[model samples]
Target: MEESKEREKEACQELPSRRDMISNLPDSLISQMLSCLPTKEAVRTSVLSTRWKTLWLLVPSLRLASHDFPDYNSFVSFLDKSLDLYREENSCLHLELVIRKDYDDDQCCVTRWIDHVARHKVKHLDVECILVKREFLEAVPLSLYLCESLLYLRLHRVLLVGSESISLPRLKTMRLEQNVYPHEAFLQFFISSCPVLEDLSIVRKDDDNVKVLRVHSQTVTSLTLGFEPGDGHMLYHYFDREILGICIDSPRLKYLNFNDDVSKCQILSSFISSSVKVHLGGVRYMSYYSGGVVFSNQQVARSFFRCISRVKDLVISETIMKLIYFCMKVEPLPQFCDLSYLEAKVCLVDVEMLPALLESCPNLNSIVLDLTRPTIITEQITAWAVPQCLLLSLEFVEIKCCCKAELVGMKLAKYFAENSVFLKKLVLRWRGYVLEEDSVLRDLLELSWRSSTCQIEVYGPLKRPVRV
Candidate 1:
């Protein structure tokens, strides 16, 4: 009988302890743990136990998405109650609200929520409203512009009406994507208000109603500007408007990604650093069907190239390459004296211009060529002049074949293999299926290399290296 009693006791003791380990933590620690979760999920934890019921009220951060709730009223009610509880308990440091449904009926409520957060000394704020109807974009409250404690701010698809009281002194990073700005002067004023801004990204839509956008900041270090055009058929409408101009006067800028096709004239201040890394892609001035290049585009391309000529690293898109080809036809391409790394997408028809392009980058040490949209190779490949970098500084070359038939890519690879004297490594990435893999490998192996120590590697469609 005693043995049976002891066995029962042992089994009872061994049963998983019902004592909640997480609940024993202090209220501060529990609130911090809950801060990382969305407000809806954090509130759900209240049902776990009585101890967690009021713990979520002390969380210092709130992340709420409107789609998480079944109805709009429920989302608004939860957000209002949470913010009220937070105000009574603690200050919120971070707040992110993503509204995916239409909020036209409750636009005032949206503005009220933003004003409330701004009053609570919120440091980091991210608001994204994805409205299917373009006409019903929610307007951002003017009070948000006066948020003195803001350190980071990101807004998407919001209407921003400028106010003279704008001041975000502590804000360091700001991203305004697809937002409606009243005017270019308002944007410049808004940017000027952020005295310590460091990183800025502006993604413009087709009809944002702003032209000649000027980004003039002394403290900005990184800037990304892109234009998102509508469908192909609607591009003609956008092109009918006046050509846009972008003037950048940031002295401390180090990185710039300019991918806007809408802007033809780009002007940079003389204070731009020579060591800036630039990526020029998706910039074209010619019509899709027309074979003729615009004269204004040629001039703009030359001026743009001159602005970024001192950059150390450059990435060119296929459209930009065509623009360069046209620019070269008028005058020789500008010399990029400090350029060391280059990545470009070249069509098969423009393969002959690759050498001329490299000649402009005399100090280039590495190059990546993406051969896309391959056409038939008709003429002999004897038009290219030997570039200075091939004999001196060029060391690494990577060629990517994006089509099934890689005849042009193979010929270009052979040309590089026979020309680059100081080449260290050559990587050929065949992204298309090959019927005969062995023959492809044998053909690459038979190519004559100018450098005795050059190592050649071929990657098949599966991205695996092929060895003899």
Candidate 2:
């Protein structure tokens, strides 16, 4: 009877658990379910039953973030075991490691993890290793370039030091941040190898070796490049003498964004696509520098504006507006014959530059001017020939101005109301408190609208500003 009871117990254990529908599913499906969770939670499946014990090992993706581990040694041990146990022939891997202290042992462990992923067929990889030290630059493992199966790769704060040509034929999207390439030419060499790459983003810090960054990708349709202050470097480092120029030579490029101090860099682009959208900014430096530094940026400003002359939509930041103000004094401004939409950020000093810019954009349909200063000398409105947009094409005018009094607001409203002939709508946004609000409204209403169809909308301190 005891022997019979033992046989029944064995049979009951082999049967599926009560009310369990998923556990009895095929091994491949179970592994697929486990792969979606973090590696820590995925490992918990081993306790479910004997069949599920080894299923976590077959998960097709391994994600190990440093914060998931209680301590560094636990993180190191967990990564070692996961990679060793990962039985899937082709697995996708993602790692987000934060190195608060610069330690060589942690870096070596990262190298080992990268090596293991490269040997396996890693299809999609995203690794972000943040080196918290001010002077440390993390070295990316060379095996990363050998992973031909990688479809998307995004790396941050990693140094690419080798002279080897990085060939990843299937990569479609790539992002590199604070990556130290040995030379500027290495940046081009790395990009040229990816034949079908579609999207690329590069954020560079002050590099000792890279004087000029020339992005020459034929396949990239979208690109975003920015330069900002690094850990030990101040914002002034962006305008240092060591960094010289940026050249963009992509013929198929349709969209571009440039965020940096224009004072120090020369920008040159090959215009193949006549219509592109461009945002040029990083003008905050103007408030701090001496007059001599501002004077030197005139040529730099001219080069940038000339490059974007072919764009249809243009947004110029306050810094860029100041640059143009300086450039206009030196050279004849380039005409933006194709430009339709114009948004400009201007201070009291830059307001003088507007008529010239507006004259250049003969076909501008809508204009949004963001006034940076709270007050302007309305009496000193420099004379300008009537702009082509004011007479014919311009239908809408939006002004974002800040003021302590209503009179300061009236000066800008009166300028546009008097000029725009075919204007359909006039919108004025007052950012701060406007004293004598009703009088300001009456004054705006009293201003003569050039077009009979023009509608006036004014928002004061009590109301939220309208979107331009």
Candidate 3:
């Protein structure tokens, strides 16, 4: 009888009704969902629910890509309608353009739209042009660069003519993707122009005709450097395009991300200023680059970190962590390093190099270790590689991924109980695969350790989530 009742309950359990679900969703939630879709499709949602009637108007983000338009005139007409429709006084605007046009119609439309938006004073703008032919792009005036409300701007795959002519005064995030131009001349023009730019990213385009790519920027806080695949013939060309230009001169830069495909390129800061901090993701790679480049995962990590030669607060991917451990155990390292707050995602910590790297961080404050999806065996943690003083200045410790908390997890618990004098909080995030109720409870309870000083928080069924 009980089994039958359980089956009935299970049968009754279904996803919330679509009407009920739509009715219950808040305006903000609806707007956010609509924002991700194409602008036209997003606008069509007004008839879905009366509650969402005004939601599209309130959607702060507007993403209109030109690729889907039937013709240039259609794109221009839609742009005019959208600008007239979306009337938020203070909302972020995300404008991405992919114009593959040989005609002057789309070019004129783009400029008119940019001028219209600038007059409205949009908060955030990200502009992208996909292979915009030379003639049309050259005609765009410098007025787009003068907008004060633009917090973000991204230009991609466009012919950079009068490189010095483009400038943004209040840009917080700027991304230049897949652009090829003469190296030093390229940056001398751009860097000297943008006065208040903070976060900047430069990605080279895929072409052999381009010989050099030079980069120089001042007052940029966050930077991302990425590379596109180059034709083999261009590799031996007269101009040494092998050197990737990365100039992060911003005094307030706190985070950095790097990606490269050409293994031979020497990454040089055509010029670097002193005020940089927080290097994030020292190495980044494209799927094609991974196949062609000789840079081992370790070598890639090494190059990435070396670029951000300045500062603290770092976030590392699991792939990068694996490489860093390999390189750190190798022969040489500069004496006193400053990386203190490090966040890593990995199942197993490299025991050998972990201690040495920690030693470099004398004034380390916190360590956030996020476990990858596959559960790392508790016994495999290189706890001993962790220096004794690692937990001394550390105030917060977090551990994740436990099917059933075992040896390595226990070692971590004991380490905290014994060594952490100032340890205030310990967070354990639970994994989701374990199915049975009893087994889940047992696995969850297994982490509750024999500790007194630190306050422990388990992430599974018993307590609040580790994440806020």
Top model number, lDDT? 1
lDDT of 2 by residue, 337-386 (tens): 88888888887656766778788999888888887765545455525457
| Model 3 error, position 169 (Å) | 4.5
lDDT of 3 by residue, 1-468 (tens): 999999887766744463457658677786677777777787787787676666777766667767678876777687777777766573436666666564655446655666666666665665666555444453233566567777777766544444445646777777777654445564556655677777677776546134445444556666776665543424334123344434434445555565543233444442322234343443343222334433343454455456644456666666556555556655443322455566766545442345565665655667776655444444533344545445457667776654543334435545544555666677665555343334433543454333345565656544444322
Q: Which is the leading candidate under TM-score? A: 1
* Position 169, candidate 1: lDDT: 95
Give the C-alpha miss distance for residue 184 in model 3, angstroms.
4.1
Question: What is the TM-score (0 to 1) of candidate 1?
Answer: 0.86
Query: lDDT tens string, model 1, 1-468?
Result: 999999999888866554577889899898878877767788899998788787887877888888888877888888888888775337777889888764556533667878888888889899887653457677788889989999999998878876878889999999998888888899988987899999999988756767777888999999988876532426566555456778888888998887865236467444446778888777453443244634446676687788788888888888888878777887888899899889999887888788878889998899999988867764666456789999898999988887753777777778888888999888788767753456666787787878888877888777678643
In model 3, what lDDT does residue 120 have?
A: 65
lDDT of each: 0.79, 0.72, 0.56
Error of 1 at 88 (Å): 5.0
Ranking by TM-score: 1, 2, 3
Quality of model 1 by C-alpha lDDT: 0.79
Q: Count the backbone clashes (under 3 Å) in each candidate.
A: 0, 1, 12
